[model samples]
Structures are given as C-alpha cells and as structure tokens.
Target: MRTNKQVYRSGPAATKFAQAVKVGDALYVSGQVGMDESGHIPADLAAQMQLAYVNLEQVLAQFDASMAHIVDEVFFVTDMQDFMSDAAAIYAARQAVYGAEPAVCHSLLGVSALALPALKIEIKCVACVAHESESHRAKASR
Candidate 1:
C-alpha cells in the first residue's frame, strides 16, 4: 500500500535523507544540528541548541508549520554533564525561542557523537498541521 507524504530537503541537498516528512496532518522533522548553511558550529551548548532550533524552524516553514505546531521533540546531546551543568541557560534559551514554556512532549538523551565531530546537539521534532478544511473553516470564522 502507498502512503501519501511530502518531503523537504536541505543540508547537502544530495543526502539520502530528507529534512522533514509530512504524512497527512503529521510531520516528522529530522534531527537538526547546530551547523549553519555556511557550516559554522558554535562551541557553546546553549548556542548550539539555539542554532539547531533555527535550523528546525527553517524546515518546518517549508511545510507552512511553526514551533507552535510541534507536538513532540527529542534532543540528542553529546555531553549530558555539560548540558546539565548549564540547564538554566539552555532552558532559558529554549523558552525564549518558543516564547513561553513549550506545550509539547520531549526527551533528552546523551549521545556519543553526531554526524560531525564538532557538533554538540541535535534536535528532532514532530508536528501536527491542521487539516485543510479545518484551516479554511478557522479562517472563515475569523
């Protein structure tokens, strides 16, 4: 059986995996790293987390979704000790990005490494979009 889905690509543009995939109303965003388009990786963990969220947001925009649409997320960090050492700063940065406490399920896991040696963190997200008809109805009511 074939399932309907949409995919968005970034990074090398020739990589085997897509940045995000949308199936029906649900979107699965691949793990986003701190590396920017110019391939710069910041040293600080909080800085890295912020940049990763920026990358994730860019992917979400491709599907007309935003952080508000995200229902779940998983954070993979290379150094949990370092992460926990500055949990306040890291979470404060996150709260700033979300504009408040994120109303979503999430997990944090310590990893040995990422695709790049310099990378410290990667964030994966899952988002839900409103059905087209529902979106239209909401717009009509407004």
Candidate 2:
C-alpha cells in the first residue's frame, strides 16, 4: 500500500508545495532555494548556498532523515563561474551535516535564473526513509 505523506513548514519562506512525498521507503524532496523563513535571500553566493541547504535540512528533518540519507542532489546555479566555489560551499555544508557519507549522487546545472531575483542557487534532493527502529528514531531526534 502507498502512504501519501505531506509536510507543511509553518513559515512564509517555505513553499506551499509538499516538501517531500513518500511512497513506502522512498522520499522525494522538492526543489529548495536559498531563502530563510522570512523569504529573504542572502546577498552572496556562499551565503545563499548555505541558506539553500538549510532549507533542505529542515524539510529532511520532517521525514526523520538527514543529509546522510540523501541519495541524490540536483544543484542549479546561475553561472558556471560560481560553480567551483559554490560547490565547495555545498560540500562543506554537507560535511557539517552528514559527516562524510559516500552516498551522494549529484547533477550540477547552469541555469539562466531561478524563481526569485535574489536566488543564485536551487537544490533538490532525494532521500530514503530510514527504518523506524528505536535507535534510528533516537538518532533522528538528535
């Protein structure tokens, strides 16, 4: 049986779209941008990238998942020149959350623009729901 799940983040910055939809063990997170709970985008690329990941992390938390559970990521950027540094920032952010898991699959795309004028990066992720063992839930709670 398929279970339809919905996560609503109570914030003006969050999207009305379901942050993730789960079918059995698989979870699909929506595209996340570099905006905070108040819908303000950061001024610089590095800050924006950090914000984007933060938003993703919040959504993942709702599913009892972390960046460690993420199997795939799609990174959209406004410019290729910003790629390397921006990628490094993302890596750093991931490391902070996931602690060097080799489970990441990624695709980077250079796009003309994103939805918001101040947004320079958008990230989408796919994660698998961890089995809800007592220990797993404990870890997720941490």
Specify the highest-TM-score model's number: 1
Per-residue C-alpha lDDT of model 2 across residues 1-142, encoded as one tens digit per residue: 6565544343554466566766557778888888887778888787787788888878777767788788988888897786675567657765675667447888889999998777888988888875543433443356
Which residue pairs show collisions in model 1? none
lDDT of 2 at 15: 64
Cα deviation in Å at residue 33, candidate 1?
0.6
59-98 per-residue lDDT for model 1 (tens digits): 7777778899999999999999999999998998998999
Give the whole-model CA lDDT for all candidates, comma-separated: 0.85, 0.74
The positional error of residue 48 in candidate 1, measured at the CA in angstroms, is 0.7
- Residue pair clashes in candidate 2: none
Please give each candidate's TM-score: 0.90, 0.77
lDDT score, candidate 1, position 58: 84
Model 1: CA > 4 A from native: 131-142
